[model samples]
Target: MLNDMSENQAGYAFAWNTPKSAINPYLDPPDPVQKSALREVIALYAADNRRHQKPGESLRNAVWDRYFFNADRDPVLREIAQDKLTGQARMARERQRFNPEQTVMDDIHAQPAWIARPLLQRIAFLKNLSRPGPCQRYLCATVRPCLDRLTRVRDDQTGPSIRQMAGHPGLEGLLVLSDMNQNQVKRLSALVAAHMAGRLESACSLLPLDNDVQPEAIRRVWEQLAAEVMRLEVIPPAFEQLKRKRHRRRPVSYDRIPGSLARMICTTWWYRRLWQRRCEWREEQLRAVCLVSRKTSPYISREMALYKREQRRKSLEFFRAHELINEHGDRLEMEAVVRASTSHPVRRRNEMMACLKGLELIAEMRGDRAIFYTLTCPSRFHATLSHGQPNPMWAGTTVRQSSEYLVGVFAAFRKAMHKAGLRWYGIRVAEPHHDGTVHWHLLCFMPPGDCSAITALLRRFAIKEDRQELGKVTEPRFKANAIDSRKGTPTGYIAKYISKNIDGRGLGKHISKETGTSLRDSAEHVTSWASLHRIQQFRFFGIPGRQAWRELRLLAGQVNRQHNGRKAGAPVLADRRLDAVLAAADAGCFATYISRQGGVLVPRRQYLVRTAYELSDVQNKYGDRSRRIYGIWSPLTKERICTHSFKWKRVRKTSGGQISPGRGHLFTPWTRGNNCPHGEKINAHHRIRVQRKEEETIKDFKNEHK
Candidate 1:
């Protein structure tokens, strides 16, 4: 019968199988009360089937047909009219209806009149009869096509609703309604069959929301989804996890003292007693983190001594190799002329000439006054040389190798000047002129006579000797000499070479265009004082004593010879300032002179800033020697090693023309001149006048004393 039953209708059948049975010895059925209830339900279904069946035919339209349609031969339902007589034979064959042996049945059988009276009373109590149980109420509610239509829409929200329906009796309600459909009916039939087979409870346990129902009936599905949405909305603050952090504390007070001083005093008892220690625990923690090194003072000192020894050895080696140091340990002087070219080959000849003239004027004012001057070649000479078109073999080197040719020429000039008692500052080679001739502007510092001699010498070697002519040179004229007067005589030459050249014009034109500064003022700003100070510190060494100067000349010669020997195919240049003559010439451009004792005297605004070498205070008695001077009070106690008699010894008077202990007196405050010794100020003296009476009293006291 279940195989023919629809799923929708199965709900009604299941509804009848409710109400737990009372314990009765005679109740053989597993669910006696439900079985009785099902019998009544089947009777109603059989009546309905009969009404729907066609008239007169077989007992198939009867209650038995709906109750047990699969019963092939039931004698009770087989009777036809007199043939299906409801007599003793059929009564004996059919099962007793509703347990006739029960007391209620016997009572009903015995009191037919009482039953009719009860029925009469129930007919007047319609309200009580209309009251519905929970199951009946759910079934009676109006079913809507909206539910079926909603299930057809594919929505993710629908699945939860379906699961929710299965969770409660709601799934049953949905199944009852949907059972009318063929697919629903098949599913319902399977569920019913499983229940009959005793596996329904276990199968339904695994279903979502604990139900065996259709998917479209849940109410809490949307609510659960909303909760899930809420759960994802706000992310928690994770700054504490993501941030980079470090642990640190206040610096130790020991760090307050500088390393140099602290190292000397750190372990002293007095220092430890005076120092304040705060937060010992934190200090210990920091100490642990720092991992203090082992105190191996002896080892450290040994290592330091070793390092010092190594350093001394390297220094000695360098000095020996380069000859920049001597037995006296003074650096050798390097007098060099630095001629930095300002001319751009692409520029006009007039512009180059102007820049050259301006630079010359600067050198002259700075006391670098060029002994001889000439401007014969045009600036376009390089282009002319290129056009001259020598054969490839003849033109062995490119124009870039101009330094090589110039170095040879400069070397020859240096030798000539040396022979003539003129000093060459350096060679400043310029580009070839429009006439295809390479010309040079020489920097030389010599006497007027020597300068004249050099002009004659130039005529001897120059390509067009007739073209080389000398001219008279004088300092440039200025409206105000205030700035000029402040400069040393040599400072004028310093100012001349340092001037900038622009647009084929000299410093005069540039100074004119500049607002707020005069030509003289501009000229004063350009001083050779700094250069002089630097050169004073410049010392050369490694020259044997007898020919020290000659050795330097040789070095200059070596530099020049290397320049000349360079392969024409290789692009090599010579340093113009390497020539001894050029270096000597440039040295004269210095405004301040350097002494072995005094360091540097650089011109500062109105005065000079002098920094001298601080000598030690250690004194040693020597044959006719003055005492030691100023510096550290601690004496240098090294044992005397050299047996040779000292060439330089300390002396006393300023006029002695000797270095002495009172050399500090020259820098002392007592010197009442522009030169303040030792950077100290002189105090003024005040005179006190004695009145006539006071003088007489003083004289009387003096006479009494006599």
Candidate 2:
């Protein structure tokens, strides 16, 4: 009679044999008490089939269609159904329900009464873990290309920029790629940050631990990442990462105290690296979330227009100081220019012409000093250049090849400036036209020299190297005149070029007004730019960059010795500044400011907010040589090797430049009158005083002197 049984609702039908429990003991399933509601539902459906009639058949997935989805349905009508094959059959059925991209582990919290978590964890973990790590295709094919379009690094610190975060063990989240429709690129970037902050618990909660194997696998990969972070502990603080094996060891600590000094250097290195990594991760986060891009008409800067109006000689003086030029018209060497570019060699000279003003801003900010000069007073020079207009011949060229070619142009331009005696601090950012050809915007610091002469030099050299190497400058290239930066102008000047080549201003803005191809579509139209081009988009030169790491290292050591142990083999406290910065963190987000009042019981506001880098000690080094160190981060060695040197060791005073050793001279980025080295209460540029030094060295020195 069951042979005539009709099909169940979902078009599924099964013939059931006479009750299997009554005939075959080997076919018996577990007792009803052990069966879950889900299982019971299956058992009842099978019994329904058996009573209906066909022999040697059982109820199929139609039961789930009937009961698992409809909570009102009850399945325990009779106890005659016992199918041992139910488990495998149910799994197979579940697998068929979702698309291949989804996993059964996704519904862990959805059905607590149906399947206990332990059972779910066991079964789901095994199945997903056995699956290969998330598809690498989305990482390479979709996300990377998009990132290459979006991320552009300005050369400031040695930390990894958003562009370089890829391939870091901290960024393994890219492995668990979701479909394109899911907007997984943003999630992948966040996951990388999560790993960097060591937020394992947060990661565990946000991602599916049992089903999506890739996230779990990504966490495991970073054990090696932690090892790399730990390995940097050997490098001295302040110095860039070791880019290559140095031919001979350059002592990071030149101290004579030996073991005590070595311990200090090692400890400082560890804290510094930790801070560097943290800062870099923070910068990456900033770029990922806050970087603003716009597609308004070409930037209109009155400062740039003013720069164009200057006489040729006047414009030349902006980059090369008038005092340094020779009577014979020979330009000062690169060293003089580099020195002059670094805050004009003395506090007396304040006019920083061109985009070079940003260099000072970079220095003061990097040294953890407060930014007193508003973006309003910026005196900078901006210029734009194009390689060729709508050239189809270079359409297929990759970003790497184009970057190499640009390097040649850069070298030629640098040589021309060196020959012509121009030392400018500026940034060069390349933007691709809709056609995929490249154009460059340079924010430079050109003195009040002959604007015509400066323009001539740029025009002459822009194509010089390309002509030299390729044996022909067949393509036409155009160089725009340099413009000076001013109020509201310098702020928008180079920043526009350096920002992501995006379309809409940002999320909350008037996106409807945005015209032209979108930033994303533009990104997709071009070949992978960042993946192939390793060069920084913006560059700085001859600017007061960093306090010599050597100086900072000594300070860190001194602080450690005093707080912990001054004797050899004795334990020392971690860096006080780093401790403050770390302690200032609320949750995983690092503090943008810290109190400076020192043990003062004032409100947090009274403590005075200071920047991340500024949270460190800077006082007492008031007049010291805050030389700029240039370098690159090596992924292979995980080191940032310092490349600049003291070629003019004799020309520049070397040792006495050490900031007077004791108190009343501590200079932080926030320290006022930082430019005026004179201890006399003098120039308005001089900030009055810094918070008293945390060290007792001043009193000791005074006592010893007396």
Candidate 3:
């Protein structure tokens, strides 16, 4: 029948109409249990395909084709079908042992959505529903309440038996809780709870052999506690280290630990705090163990650093020798062009300073008050104390996690301000703490009357977590200072931070307060930290965006080129507002540009000029169409001006007096004169002719002398 039908019809018939016994006679017919499991699997497969399917595609057909028609050809699909059939067969056998009226099939069908989820997700859901043991019940009654107050996770969400939660992939390898008794589970639960509550000392006290816990059990519990509380993804080096030294009964001391284990412990708050009490660590030791160690930071490795350095070297070499040639025969050397672009560190720093100064000037003219605020993450996010000691309150949070926390707080603060109808403008600089936690320095300008309200809202969000630890003073978490012009300018206040995070220029011999190192020496580490965490270092809000500013600058350059060295007036822009913005950007006056485009309070849609983008002819590396900014569009004038009129390509330069062995041709070296309207082919031909004439003259001279 299949041979008589077309391929599509055969596929459809085999997928929908054919029975399992028909396909393979030895295979038994699917019972209700197996059929239900198959349906669930097919339903999930269809849902997943629906997410990625095109508009007119049928998910039903796609699922059938994938599971039935293609199963024989595709190993993955065949394995999945076999696994579902085998698992359902086994489950059907187990269902026979239970009541015939209420089988596992009924339960599976009752929550098909839950059954369709991944194994780990299902485990997490079941773990949450599982009843708590005695120790977990105690923690839920005491420790969980405090944690609930501090974290977004509610008490109900954190519901116990933590032994069941051990099903997490990260914890599965560290502990074998399946064989443990009630006493062991109670002890492990209590220890994890104590560590979570910043009570590592109390947890350690419970680890003594006198508590009726086996030495091996204590070791496993400690490892599990460290892994879970610190949120470590991999088995800690301490586990293997302790295994190698199984002869010892007590837990290892900090000084006697391996560097990898030491780094892990020092990077976590409670563990670091416990170690500090046991041993006095010097600043150098702390730096060596925490800052310099790469064991914990996987995003940046020695290989990656070497790769980046090599790439930088090649980029510099390429930029130094090559010239970018446009379709109009216009050429610009790549090095000079790149240095002027925003990606350059020095250029970016200068632009940021100019933007800040511009905002300050505008604020002064409008009678707005300048307020400098330092927003920090809660104590739980910090890894170390200010004096280079481990913070007892640190919860083993990573730099990326802390950065995200600050971003969330700032977002909330912005939302609150928006609701309150307050307008502000300024720059925010994110820099890492000494221990690699990120904090933000925001220089904001707001009306004098609204300053207090804004500060209050920010303080409320910044200290929302671990508020009790903040005590009576919240300055350590959220600090606000009115920029007093009598002492120094607002630009001066933030300049050091900006330079310290960037190139650290003009900061002669100044030391960083956080790291206690020379600002110049520590700047590289700060930059690496930011890069490793993928954090945005600087952001400007309540101003015309940087893209529009850059485009305007390009337009101004175009206008300058149009009338360069001529005795004619400069070309006029399409609109008066456009002309003003172009002039301001040309003059490097960010304040004027901001005002002409739209003041700090105006929305993006209301801006006089905006960036215009077009879909590219080529797809990106991911095989998706990407948009490229090509020109500027003026909303007021209803005109679009294409600033990028010519496409440019980088060409390698040939050195002077160089001859290729294959062709015996003398190459013309690239020079400013040769880059003019004179074509490169003409120059090369002329140079070849001159060289040939010289060679003939030399031959004649040699013959006459002979």
Candidate 4:
């Protein structure tokens, strides 16, 4: 009957020849128990087959015959044998489920010869399997064959050693690799490969490992070494497994390594490189999430924005409640004092614009030329194309790396200009590309004769790498234009950029050419990009440093206070030049300030005055002493003038209803400028003591907390 059935009508069948009692040996009267347990299974199976069978065929008779008959034309007594087989298969599958801890042991046991090997050889095999990249792949591919070979070769026998067979001529420089710890080996291997491949230009570039070498360089070199090692093959399975496990673990900060051993490891080149890569990866992951959230929600959630606003309002209220009192009994609200400083965004922007305008005016008066230049990184540094597709040529370069590259290029240009005896002063504005790579826009003022030389030097350094990508026109890499008086002022050209990066004010309906998004919509992302990368957006070079300028202003304030009510002709400083600089700073005239400070061309030490700093009495939270600006010192007069004459202290506010100091009340003098040396530790101790006191005050605190 089965042979007569069509292929589709004859469903899959299981054969059994054993007695029915054998299917369930523990249960007596197995027929009833087995039938009850398998009734659902048998009915489902019969129904499935019946759906596919001919209409006239009896599904019940077919299932009965199929379960009872054997392949040999013999009557099978066991009716539940198929069910037992199904249950056993499922149990075997459950047993084979993946467990990271057991997988290695199971693999080792599969090769019986490995169990009897010497301890050293067994250890080597396990280490090789645990490592990532080529070593692990090689071990996995030839595990069985290699183990058999090892078992056949005795200690007394002479044969090719595993080390000799595995060694590559290119990696001979790393001969002592096996003896070193994992981090050392990885660092040495990467260094050797980078040197051999000529990826690292000079040995000096790798020194002062923490500071000199950029994280991007480390990331690139390690990636190159990894690629070369695992060329033409998929990533090692062990590495993938370990990577998954690491991702599942809680996030670890790379800012500070806790243990001495870990810090020692971080000192190595490879580890530092890995640290940078990990940081970049984390930032990119976060940025991606934020971008997605912004896309899905057109505007920021009103509740979260309002909550943040409320937090700011409360903080301002708290600050307003306190006053920073100087020794003279003068008091100022902390909130008002801080907000009046240049740290405020609107104030900073206004100051920068004023400075730029002053510089341009000075340049015009001196018959100097104003030139605007735009500098961009190479194409490979960009992670995405203009159309928003991932660039295939990008090697995982990040915005921070691109910004660093631009900075280095500018530094080189500066050095070249200094060597050639060129004089120029300007401001540099770093802004992010639509895809987050950084580019620079510079508005420089130079003598008419030196403008060409400056432009040539900038272009040379900017296009030094991947010069071909610019084709016949090099403007894509570096562009220069003479500031035509008819078009607009140099300050006007850069003012919009400053506004866009800062607060996006007055940029109504303006669209970004790079992303085709509204400038107002993308301004927040641009600001966040600069902040996340810690890139300085606006920097003015070839002028007096801002620190000295601030110190001069402080000195001017002190002078004004001293002569407030006195009949003094003029407030005298240490020298005449110092008085002029003080006046310029007081009037907010940057051009006069720059001229009085020995012009933009003069070196820093030759300036009229400099900032004087003194070491703090107490160490900071990091247990390191830091310098604080105390006064201004005139280089010409060789005289020091103290500006920070009065010490201020922070204290809690007292209301009108609060008790005032009485005759018997004891007053504790403020020491160390009222700054706690170990603020964090003291705060933690106070919290613990308050909690204990609260527990003592309340009897049922523990039960209530639970």
Candidate topping lDDT: 3
Error of 4 at 468 (Å): 2.1
**Model 4 Cα lDDT, one tens digit per residue, 608-641:** 8898777665554343345676567776766566
Ranking by TM-score: 4, 3, 2, 1
Candidate 4 global CA lDDT score: 0.57
Q: What is candidate 3's lDDT per residue for 1-706, written digit by digit as tens?
A: 6665565456664666643434654686655655578899999999988877764367677877888777689899889999999999898777756643234224333422311222224234445765735333323332223222323212222234343445543333113332333354445444433434443444566676575866565555455445554442334444554544738777664422333333333324333332222111111122222322222221222323444457578889978866565554455656866775677789888988998889989998889998999988888766445643345565545566788888888888788889989878898999876666678999999999999888888889988988898899988998899999999999999999999888888876997655566787656666765655578999988888888888777655544433445334343564556677888888899889888887888888998888987765554333334466667787676656665544555565557522224322222222222112212121121121111122233233223222
* Cα lDDT tens digits for candidate 1, 511-538: 4332233444333221121111111111
Give the top-scoring candidate (TM-score).
4
Q: Judged by lDDT against the true structure, how good is candidate 1? A: 0.29
Q: Tell how far residue 561 is off in model 3, in angstroms.
A: 2.0
| Comparing 3 and 4 on lDDT, the stronger one | 3
Residue 615 CA displacement from its true place in model 3, Å: 1.6
Cα displacement (Å) at residue 705, model 2: 42
Using lDDT as the measure, what is the rank order of every candidate, best first? 3, 4, 2, 1
lDDT of each: 0.29, 0.33, 0.59, 0.57
Indicate the residue-level lDDT of 52 in model 2: 79
After the best TM-score superposition of candidate 4, give how far the Cα of residue 405 lies from its true spot, in angstroms: 0.7
Candidate 1 vs candidate 4: the TM-score winner is: 4
